[model samples]
Target: MTRILVVGATGLVGREIVRKALRDDRITRLIAPTRRPLEPHPKLHNPLVDFDRLPEDAGWWAVNSVICVLGTTRAKAGSDQAFRKVDYDYPLAVARLAHRHGAMRFALNSSLGAAAAPRLLYSRTKGEIEAAITAVGFSSLTIVRPGLIGGDRNEFRAGEWIAARVLGALGPLLPRRFRISPAPKIADALVEAAIAGASGVHLIEADQLAAD
Candidate 1:
């Protein structure tokens, strides 16, 4: 009966993770703190929260593991600062809080080309958050870097939609690493890593994501 926390549980991949976590026998408790309320579930403890004013001493922070699918696009965020707040600041804050509350395992849904130093703002933010979370001292850290995640998003992403079409047409012609990564597959990886609580640091790359 493992207790787990899932941030960004409202998004595409996050929603999938939440659904799977709730159904999973391994997880006994699922804490999802979101801007809006999530559908009630017996195993789930949904907390309405404001990211800018996260309650530092909340009891819900106590969990065995945490999976962060918290991320946003520059366009959607409207500004570079806003984008950074979501992609970098919020996840790291959750990691620190969860780690302080004794969460040993942490799983992050990151992008394919994340790097410490990158030309793109999106990749750079992802890399920075990855580094930030690593410093939080979680015993088990899993970073799942997925590429071109395929799913029916509530909001339309022109670039992702276009890319998905192109990649879908390319199909097996492209390398496994470059292929479309289904949202559920990525969700499964995050859930597995969180529940398994594997030791040390692990990076599940796009190619590996395509495998199972």
Candidate 2:
């Protein structure tokens, strides 16, 4: 039986990941942690967590794999430091805990152009987190770099909504790397990667994510 842990369960990508994982027969259990609590499900368990101060309980980390979809925009986070805390610190912390608790695989939802030397703070933060998690020595690491994700979001971000609508209209005319991929497609890819049991880091680009 495969038990999985999903962080950022309330977000757009995270929510779909949980939904898909719950339906997968391979996943015997799904542990979802969020800042705000989520409703109960037969195969899913929700844990309320404080990002700044995660609980000491080791139970949640004792899963087969850990998928991190935790992220926030600069506008929503209010500052670069705040955004880094969510995009970098919190996810890295979860990765460390998951590794220590015996998780073999770690999958993350990163962004396109993530690099440690980038001028963009968001991309740099994500790169740093990826490096940090890699250092933890997980047996398998899957880093998914999805471009402008298209889906109904929990929070109203006018920028994202406009971008999605615009890209939706443009369709195949847009660049493959810049195209808007569906949330459910990305979620499906994550589950497939986990189930495949492929070892080592796999960098899934926007085109590959959209193809999935």
Candidate 3:
């Protein structure tokens, strides 16, 4: 029986991850900590929490695996530091707590251009969080780096919508790596990696995300 923790249960990719995990017979239990409440389920332990102060001693952190889909856009966050707090700080906090509580597997939904020294703050922050989580010592760490995530987001961005539409139209013509990655497919990969509990660090790049 695999017990799982999902940190960003309310976001685009996170929401899909939660729904899929619920229907997955391999997952015996699921813990989702978010600012808002989720729909009630028999297998779910949904806790309303402030990202700044997660409950370290909570029993829900003691799961077989963890999948973090937490992220925020700079425009929505309203500042660079605020964006880092959501994307980097929140996920790292969850990773450390889950690792301390004996969660052996960890999976992250990262961006395509994540790097330690990227010119873009967004990419750099994502890279930094990936490094931070790796330091937490999970037995199995899976990092799924996808291109611009294509989905129906609750929070609308005019620029993102236009880009997605263009990419959707040109998807077949573009190379696999350049094509947009669907949210549901990314969620499936994250869930499977967590449940599989494969040893060592594994990276699923933007191109691999297009494959089964």
Q: Candidate 2: TM-score?
A: 0.94
**What is the per-residue lDDT of model 3 for residues 30-93, given as tens digits with 9 covering 90 to 100?**
9999899999999999999998989889888899999999999999999999999999999998
Candidate 1 — what's its lDDT? 0.92
lDDT by residue (tens digit), candidate 1, 20-87: 99899999999999998899999999999999999999999999999999988999899999999999
2 or 3, which is superior by TM-score? 3
Instruction: Give per-candidate clash totals.
Output: 0, 0, 0
Candidate 2 lDDT over residue span 106-152, tens digit each: 88888888894588898889789888988989888988889898888
Q: State the C-alpha lDDT per candidate.
A: 0.92, 0.85, 0.90
Best by TM-score: 1
What RMSD, rounded to one decimal, does every model reach?
1.2, 1.6, 1.4
Candidate 2's displacement at residue 122, Å, is 1.1
Residue 29 displacement in candidate 3 (angstroms): 0.8
Against the true structure, what is each candidate's TM-score?
Answer: 0.97, 0.94, 0.97
Candidate 2, superposed: residue stretches over 4 Å from native: none
* Candidate 3 Cα errors over 4 Å, as ranges: none
